[model samples]
Target: MVSVLSPAEVKLPDGSSTDFANLDVAATAPCLDVVAEAVADLLPWYGSVHRGAGALAQRSTREYEQARETLYEHLGCGPGDAVVFTRNTTDALNLLAHVLPPGTTVVTFDVEHHANLLPWRTPVRIGTPRSPGEAVATLDEALRQVSGPVLVAVTAASNVTGELWPVRELAEVAHRHGARIAVDAAQLAPHAPVDMAALGADYVALSGHKVYAPFGAGVLAGRADWLDAAPPYLAGGGATAGVSADFAVRWHDGPARHEAGTPNLIGAVALATACRVLAGADLSAEAHLVARLRAGIARLPHVEELRLFDAAAPRVGIVSFAVLGRDPDELSTELGRDHAIGVRTGLFCAHPLTRRLLREAAGRLDPSAEPPGAAIRASLGIGTSEEHVDRLLAVLSAPLFGE
Candidate 1:
């Protein structure tokens, strides 16, 4: 397991301190010790990349460029792929949205997080599917109607439900219909190893924060042809090749074209280090924890596990559920206040899916009550211990939670 800052002590609402069981790893993961060490070592030698003539600048340029290579190898990007650094996943997807050729259609499902759903210029949305085959068929049918260059945008996993999507199958479907695919891997990359070529995805976006390297860094890795043909995402010194006094600027091609301003040197290094480390990481233990958590949820009759497909669908270390007649926010608060357990409560930023799942759960659990607006999510990560999982299960299994 990755060495992350863990079991952090936090003061309870009642003024007592306890080791916090951070079950909200899906939101923002705790920083890895290796990433912190790497950043600390770079602070003294940090300098502007691609501009200064000093030794530090030269070293900084090498380090920054090497970081890009790390990410390239991490994702198994194609020979001509451009690994452009951005603020985070949102910024990366927005960059892709901007660089897409004019009149290109963006086809995506409605169950996507806001980051993937909103960046497109009037996207053609497909309805949510009950199964992976249905999802692939829906995209194929949708693409058959749209005439032009199309980009199929989809998430590798559902943030709200933690169910893994069939990205490879979706990519094949997109290609069969003369369209390319871009994956929003913000949630998937941290939990599983991602390969661009294997998935047949043209573009992949992910954030550092979710990958245990949180310092405001992300990457948009994909084919360079569209990026080179399109205008720069941002205009500044690094992006331009030559600018005359008359302001006739010739822009550079590739990653530098989009990464215009002074880049986040530290953040990039941290992000790259995380990707490199996670490439060979052993997460079977965390998988066990996920199995245990889901099994525990199964024992509680009042708990309705949120999922897009059936329980057999592959997922990460995230388990979201709504309890019968319980307020999700209040449940999260009680866990935090009394048991030092931290869980997330809300729509999980994928509103359409959450609402649909909640409504479906409402019908099955109790038709008399209204649908829940939110759910309680307990996600595991590198630092999550068996004790954390057991404690959370114990709290939810208490007498107050019984039917």
Candidate 2:
């Protein structure tokens, strides 16, 4: 297993310390040992890239550019693709939105994280699907209604339910309708292999923090045509070849057109190193943990594990659930405050999907019961252990947790 930084122990409200079991890898994974080392190794020679004549600057430029190549290959970018680094998935998607053609219509699902949903200019939102097949069919139907230039943005895996989407099918549907597809892979890339060619994706965006390289770097990798033709994302020295006092500027094509000013050298290297480490590593261990966790949750009659598709569908080591008549905020707080465990609670940035699932689950359980506004999400990573899963299950077994 890849070595991750130790999350260490947490202190209880009574000032007692205990081992902290982190089950929130879906929110932000603990840093990898190799990612931290890469950052440390690059820090000593840190220098601004692009124009400096010093050896450090030249070396920095090489490292920064190499990071781009590493991400491009890791993401399965096409030969004509351009890899542009940004702050995170949100920034990356926003850059794409900025560069899109004037009359281009954007299509996305209501299930997206705010990162994917908010950046587009009046995106045509598709309704949530009951199954993977329904997703593709629904998207196809939605696309058929719209005309002109269209870009279909979809999530590779859902952040709320950990359910994997039908990216390849969606890609085929988009192409059949004369549209392009972009993948919001912020959640999927960390848990599974994302091959752009295999998925037939034209663009992909992902964040470093969620991939065990939390130094504030992200990637937007895809076709170069639109990006190359757009104006510079940021009008600054490195992005422009020539500038005049009257505000006229000549912008460089490719990645540099979007990545203006100074780049995050250490962050980029760390992200690239993490991408290399996690690329095709053993995922069965995480799957085993998921199986154990879900099975344990099933034993708790009051607990209802949230899912978007069939009960037997495969997930990426994440389990979101609701306990009868319990507020998720209070449950998550008590878990951390008293039991020294870490998990995420609330809508999880996928507001529409989360709320809809909660409502649907509520209606199934009892028509009189109100839908929960939030849910508890326990996500696993390479660093998560079987003991941690068992520990969480044990804690939840206590009948009067609120009392």
Clashing pairs for model 2 are none
Could you tell me every candidate's TM-score relative to the true structure?
0.97, 0.96
lDDT of 2 by residue, 1-403 (tens): 6888975677789988877888999999889998898888888889978878898998999999999999888888878999999999999999999999888999998888999899899699998788999999999999989999999999998888888988999999999999999999999988888789999999999999999999999989999999998987887877987888997888898898988888888889988999999995776688889999999988775677888899887778789987767787888888888887899999898888888888877776677788787889999997788998998998888654543
Candidate 2 has its poorest 10 consecutive residues by lDDT at: 394-403
Q: Count steric clashes of candidate 2.
A: 0
* Candidate 2 structure lDDT: 0.88
Give the winner by lDDT: 1
Model 1 clash tally, residue pairs: 0
Please report, as a residue range, the 10-residue window in candidate 1 with the lowest summed lDDT.
394-403
Report lDDT (Cα) of residue 135, candidate 2.
92
